[model samples]
Target chain A: MSVIIFADQFQGKVKKSALEAVQYGAQIAQQLGVPAVAVAVGEIDGAELSALGQYGATKVLHVADARLNEPEAGAVTKIVAEAVAKENGAVIVFAHNFAGRSIAPQLSARLKAGFVAGAIGLPDTSAGFVVKKNVFSGKAFANVSITTGKKIVSVMPNTFSLNPGGGSASVEAFAAGLGDADFKIKTVKVETVSGEVPLTEAEIVVSGGRGLKGPEHWGIVEDLAHALGAATACSRPVADSGWRPHHEHVGQTGFTVRPNLYIAIGISGAIQHLAGVNGSKTIVVINKDAEAPFFKAADYGIVGDAFEVVPKLTEAVKKYKGN
Target chain B: MKILVCISKTPDTTAKIAFTDNNTKFSEAGVQFIINPYDEWYALVRALELKEAQGATVHLITVGGADTEAVIRKALALGGDEAFRVNSDSQDSFFIASQIAEIAKQEQYDIIFTGKETIDYNGSSVGGMVAELLGLPFVSIASKLDVNGGTATLKREIEGGEEVVEVSLPLVLSAQKGMAEARIPNMRGIMAARTKPLKVVEPAAAETLTSIVSFELPPAKAGVKMIPADQVEELARLLHEEAKVI
Candidate 1:
């Protein structure tokens, strides 16, 4: 038996989340006393596949199908299933991102394997295979046990720290007999956000809310985020008012983030907003309203006008960084 | 055209989360339930818009016990033609998907719509499972959708940006924000919803692969440390030295 990790890639580069998955799968393999094999599909570089070994993947299964450049869930499921069958995989690991969320469920249904999406920690095999995951939009945690013999788990991004050690993995080409039917969903166009850390993957995030007054005042938020080398986010109302794009909205009905550090500026902490960001390791709140609910949930709070405090905070961060 | 939209009830976003039965089950006491926003706002509303534009039938489906009828009726009031309640209390994602897939297979819906994920479990598993069970193509987290002829064009969020995809009819889509605007039930619609058909059906034979062993709330914060507004640099120092996160 082996643990199989889906080494998800975009434009030939492996994602940070994929490396996390590999490390997670390797830990599971250690628990089971089995090898962790990473399966890569589409147009990925051979050197990049070999580098997965540093994350504890013992071997890499490469399916060099250029068509997979745009991941069609159905087609990718078939390829992973084939890899699992060949390797006698007992557990399948994926990063619970957009691609994993789309593909893992189909794979679970196709294999009749028990799946736990958005898993936050390693499974407890001491008794049974119980995986811990956030539920209620991070308001609570659920310890879900997968009873099926074959198991699938999609680890939430940023849940685990990356620990790359010294090693090398042997890459082997695997052929998945896929047909046109497997590629039914056609990708007509692709638009990638360039030169910025994606919110979901950002280690540190700086966010603003309606208190910023308007889109023009967004520079202060962006300035702090830039100083911290973090991604920028906003509250729902700010996005609703078109002060920021919908994708930057970090709240309920938007992206859920668990960054190492999250700074909320001028945002009243609504429950819906907290649901998405409460999981951050450290929360910093800055608002003139000391009674803003966000202050109650914050680790460090500054009761001041955001227009005045944010620019100063940005300068402090830059000064701290010796810039 | 016939469309099947799946909706589920969830605790209001503000509802305090607590567990009963040795932390194995969610406590329903003092908790108000509403139609999951993603389903009601995006999936159901988008389906109603499609129905209004193309003169199609919109049917709502849910997998829950009798208490879910209120939410189902609310969905019907938002312009669904009929509704179905698969009589089961199972929280298992696969079991729920199987129940919906059985109904869709028998009814032969041209399109299946579901929320990207429920607010309670936050498991976005059912739509894909249902699609796989019926051997249909699935597109998830669709932000925008346009249908013409027998094909549908959709835009879905990728990691960094978005990708536009095209799929034929008889597919499943899990809707997210930007799909449609949320609608409220008018007085007339509310009155009409009372007389709408809500068919209760038994669940099909499906195995529940996962069970919740326990539940736990996050550790409470040790109260906020207030810093003087003028000493913003002190806050940065604490973040760097104390929090060590920077």
Candidate 2:
């Protein structure tokens, strides 16, 4: 039996989180005294698939099914089940990103395997397999024990460092024996805002709240974000008011990020907003109100008007970076 | 069309999360519970909009006991026509999915909607599991969804992108942000909801696949180091040299 990692791909290219999953699975495989293998469904670059070995996969199974390219949960579930059966996979690892969140549960149901999502650390295998996950947003933590023999773990992105050391992986094609009837959803088109770092994968993020006043003042947040080469995000009110797109909203109801550095401008840091960003390694809050709740959670606080402080901060970063 | 929107009761976004009973149980005392924002804002609102436009019957469903009835009524006040409370504590995502799937199979709902995940548990698994159990197409984390004839158009958030997909009716979708705006309960809607039908159903037998072994609070942060507004350059230098995160 081997540990199978779902190496997620975007338009035939492997993503950073996918490599992280590979490394995680490889680590678990080492703990289990078994080989770690990766399974990629749909179109994939063979060279890239083989490169997964660098992240610890000893072998990569590429299921080049055209129908599996789109983000369809059912079809991917069937394919993963087939791959698991073929590889005698005892444990499956996935990066707790969009694709993993979509497909992992369905696979768990199909296989009756216990599943854990948003796992922040490696599993504790002393007595029984226990995985630690974020609960109550980021305020609390729960250690879950999976009783089932077959298990699925979706590791949170940016939580685990990617350690590349293994050599090349042997890539092989596996037939899913799937038909057109396997997929029912028809993908019409994909529209991306494009050219901005995804919040989940970004190392640094610059976020704005209602303190920025209106959409016209977003340039300050954008400028700081550009200066730091970080992703841009907004609080829930900003997204709800249409001052920014929902995708840029980072809060309890929005996307959760664990960037290395999170800079909050004009944000009051409500409990909900802090839930999403408390995972950041370092937090900086800039607001005029010294009593703003955000300052309590910030590693560093600047009590000033964001409109004035943000531009000066941007200039400072630009000057520091010599850009 | 018949729509089923799953609502989860969660602590108010501003509630100070606390745990008691040796940190095994979430402390409910003094903590205000509300309909999960994702469900109230996205799933329920979208369903209400569909009901208004197409004369569809929207039903709000939750898997809990008396503590959740108020939240269910809140959902109805926000615009659902009816409500159902599965009379059992949700054991886990699998058990919750099983309960929902059983009702959905018997009722043959034209569409099912749920928030991406509950704020408390944050397990984004129930919708997909229910879809799998019911043999229906599942679109997850859908930011935008529209129904036309027998087909449903949806935009789901992917990594750094959005995907536009279409599936036929009798499908399931997990609502995310941007699906719909949150609506507050008006006086008329609240009065109307007081008389709305809220049926309690016995939960079907199901086994939880996982259990919480223990709970702990996150490590406390160090006290914030205040930087004067005039010291912007120093702050940047500290970020670069001290925090080493710039």
Per residue, candidate 2 scores C-alpha lDDT tens digits across A163-263 of 78758999989887777777878878876667778888898999999999999999988889989989999998898788998899888888889998999
TM-score of each candidate structure, all chains considered together: 0.99, 0.96
i-RMSD of model 2 (Å, 1 decimal) = 1.2
Off by over 4 Å in 1: none
Give the lDDT of residue A3 in candidate 1.
Answer: 100
What RMSD, rounded to one decimal, does every model reach? 1.0, 1.7
Q: Report the lDDT tens digits of candidate 2 across residue range B40-69.
A: 989999998988888899988899988899
